[model samples]
Target chain A: MIAMPDQPSRKPLVELRNLSKHFGEGQARVDALRDVTLTICSREVVGLLGPSGSGKSTLLNAIGCILEPDQGWMRLDGEVVYENRWLRGNLRRLRLEKIGFIFQTHNLLPFLNCTDNVAVVLHLAGWKKSAAIARAHELLADLPVDHRKVAMPGQLSGGEAQRVAIARALANRPRIILADEPTAALDSVRAGIVMDLLHKLAVEQDAAIIAVTHDEKILGRLDRIYRMVDGALSS
Target chain B: MNLAFRDIRHKLGRFVLTSLGLSMLLGVVVTMAGIYRGQTADALALLQATRADVWIVEAGSHGPFAEASRIPGDTREIVARMDGVSEAGSLTLQTVQLVQGDRRLRLQIIGYEPGRPGGPATLIAGREITSNRYEIIVDRQTGLLPGEALKLGRRTFTVVGLTSGIVTLSGDSVVYLTLADAQQVQFDLAPPAARREQARGAARGSTDLVNAVVARVSANIPASLIAAEISRWKHLSALTAAEQETLLTRTVIERASRQIGLFMTVLTLVSAVIIALIVYTLTLDKTRDIATLKMIGAPDRTIIGLIVQQALLMGVSGFIIGTAFVYAFRGVFPRRIEMLPADIAGLFVVVVLVCLAASALGVRVAVKVDPARALAG
Candidate 1:
């Protein structure tokens, strides 16, 4: 059990202790993740810096509950989710309830308009249709892309779609948000705007956010920054 | 569910086009199935019209439609003498060309006893044959009506009654006549040929050979047993009504039925391929979106469900349109296409299975999508 920090007894929203992941076995084996430990307290914006093949994605996947680490102790919001073995029950529900993600591409379903695309996660989380849409509208209204809420992803500009994606990630009010190269597709100006938006969301929602990027311009906005090299992390 | 439905709505044009194509294919399949069933119904109609429990034909020959069968007309009397036989009558069938104005129409003349086991049960128009000499009852399809004179060999017969749907196994129009008149039409020579034969001093040959003897058995008596007993006489073959229908279905229309079966199989395979291709293409188009969804914590099953739901929706839409098309165009078909509730139900089951199988390809692709692709430069 993690002891709550004395300052208002705030708990770590996400904790990764000695997490390790290896791909394949025998001569072809590749160690994608070495022993790595990290903690993200509530409302903290943590930047994960890495070059190509530095295991940033592997770490993100493990933290996001998409890829199980071969050896690890992972706690989300003070619950031991992975310790030697994955939690067998409701991993999907856990992700739906506690995790959000944003990728480089907007990744909006082309068939759905921006609002519907954002509302889909809330729907999966079992919110009523009216309530989910209401929430989606609220989130989209806050984002810079709300003006295009009725437009499909195909109709939106690159920056507008990315903003919509950020709004979608915030739809379920998750405890933690993981963004992998979320601004990689945008120009520097748009990339700075997206990073600022992520920073604002982390502080306003009081949600821990781990954003993995190699972009130098956005690193200054993060409250804490860690660099990954050869599957290990260094501050 | 909302996402799936929204996806379909957004791609409405492509979805509609695909569904229409699938509907046309399904319609052809349904029509072929209906034709097979219709042929079977027509083949059995002649047997059903006789309303007999047993059929007695020549040994080593199938009766009525499959092959030629000839038994002496006196065989009916012999069959009637059997212990369980109630009544027995001879039926003869002969196909001939008839002239009406400038049109030469093919007609299948069926000879039956007027008030016995081998006549049509009801007449749609006019009256049943009261005189056996020159009166005829014709099916409506033959275009003959009461008071019309029909040329049979050298004699002219007055059409007395008209029946509906009395088509023969070969799909030719049926005309019912008395045994004697049918014998003349079937075996009697032209006046010139008869005169030539008489000049040669040839003995007159009896035209008493009939296609088959239809016998009605007593209630509670097994028709198969009576048929077995008749088969022991060596001169004739006997079949229960059920067996005769099987022979007619299996032998008479065997080639056409097999051809239709083969066509249906090929069509089903083609439909499956088309569905798979369409679904796979759609999945390919949405790959990046799917990767994005996965990166956003959408479960693999969720993505799989979306693909499968789309496929099933497409199939159901296509099937409904196809069924409607088949019903709408039924009348325009030259051959009878009889659609039955059971046939539609069976086809529906097959279509559902095909859709499920076809969707497997898309599901596999969706599940294998790499979420990391969403982050790749």
Candidate 2:
């Protein structure tokens, strides 16, 4: 068991200790993570750097509360959410209220336009439709993508869709944002622009952001960077 | 709700095309159900038009349709003398081919007394059969109008009046005539053969036997009790109005009813499977989007709701279009397609249930999607 992090006067916004994840069983079991520990304070943009097959994505999933780890303690804003193989009651509600996620594929719902895509999370989190749409418009205007707010996923360019996805992630004003390779599909210019937006949103909104990326160009903009190798994080 | 409506609008062409296909399937299903209901209604209409309380036929035989039933014509007088019996009439039923112009039309001839209980209730055109001979009342669906001439055996009869919706169990049109005329047509053999047979049998009689006896009872009398008393007599089977209807449906059209029921069940099952496939395919196309939604903290219930709403929309749209199409084309159907309100309501309930059940496949697939896959490179 890993020692519990000391609870200071103001605790970290997100924490993971001794996290491990293994896929399959017995002979086929492959350990994807091994005793990983990490943290991100509010208003910080932390970058997770690694080569392919590293545990960066595995760590991100554990933080997102999507994959239950084999052994770990996970906390969001000083709350002990997971220990080893179990989660606290109402993890779904917790996810809805506390977490947002962005993926490499710009996985916007094709059926919904940019604005509705962004507003969906707030709607799911029990916001009224008008309020959710208003918030979505505000976020899009902030990102300066409001001109294409009515465009569908198929109608938007790669960078525009990714920005819409980011707007969707911020819809519920979550405490933590988990972005897995958010810039992987864009060109260098577009990638830098998206990373800048992520950094600006993190600092301006006082939200914690952990973006896992293989793109080294955006690494310099991160507040801190951690590299992962062979299922473990390294300084 | 916003997402659901927006998604449907965004994919309007695909949704409408799929709905059209579903509507066609529903149309066939509704038509099948209507046909079955029509069979039941037709059976009831035959009984209702008779205006009789009791039916008497040969013992151990289902009369009017199932088998040949011949009882002495004097049996009507015997039943009229029974307790609670007010009036009785003899009726004969036979299938014959009538020639009109160059066409040969098959008809079920019904013979009844002119002023008795077994006559037609109303005529839609022309006058009722005033002359005892050489005049016939034809079902309007038979395509014969007033003053049309039809040749039956060596006799030419003029169509006096036309009645509606009086087809036989076999779907053949019906022709109603006086007892004397119907007896001649029903017992008419080749003239030489009839003479030779009569000579050989050595039986010449003025009395004409009928296939069955129809009796009207006093409204105060219990028909069941009268039927029971008549059944007590040897060599005769008696049925009340309700029993006669049951016998017609159970014994007369039982095979056709079973066939129609099986067809309806098969169509319903086919409809369910088609809906399931369409929903499953639609969900499969959106697997990645669903995973992303799941990863973004959309609950399982939300995803399930989205899929189910789509299925229900498809079902409702299909049902509305199908109902409209059935009603619009009902008259053009060769056989009657009776669309009753109860049947429509029942089909609506079934369609909703089928939609819910069909959506289960999509819901299962959506729930099983891995949120990790949304992040995978």
Using DockQ, give the best candidate's number.
2
Best by lDDT: 1
Off by over 4 Å in 2: A1-11, A24-29, B2-5, B58-62, B73-85, B98-104, B189-207, B224-237
- For candidate 1, lDDT tens digit of each residue in A145-222? 778889989998888988998998899988899988887878888988887787677766778989998888787778
Looking at model 1 chain A, report the run of 10 residues with the lowest lDDT sum: A1-10
C-alpha lDDT of residue B224 in model 2: 90
Model 2 over residues B170-278: C-alpha lDDT tens digits?
6678889899999888666335766786879967665478988999998899999998898888799888888888888887678887888798788888989999999
C-alpha positional error of residue B339 in candidate 1 after TM-score superposition, expressed in Å = 2.1
Model 1: clashing residue pairs?
A: none
Q: lDDT tens digits, residues A81-174, model 2? A: 9887555776667777888888888789898888889998888888888898899999999877999999889998888888999998888888
The models' CA-based lDDT, in order, is 0.85, 0.85
- Per-residue lDDT value at B5 in model 1: 73
Q: What tens digits encode model 1's per-residue C-alpha lDDT throughout B1-377?
A: 45667888998998999999999999989999999988888888878888889999999887767778988889989999999999998899888887787878888888988877888877899998889699999888777779999988888999999998778776778899999899888865435787688679999767888898999999999999999999998988999999988888778889989999999999999999999999999998888878777766678778988888898899889998999999998877867788999999999889889988999999898888887676665
Compute the DockQ of candidate 1.
0.41
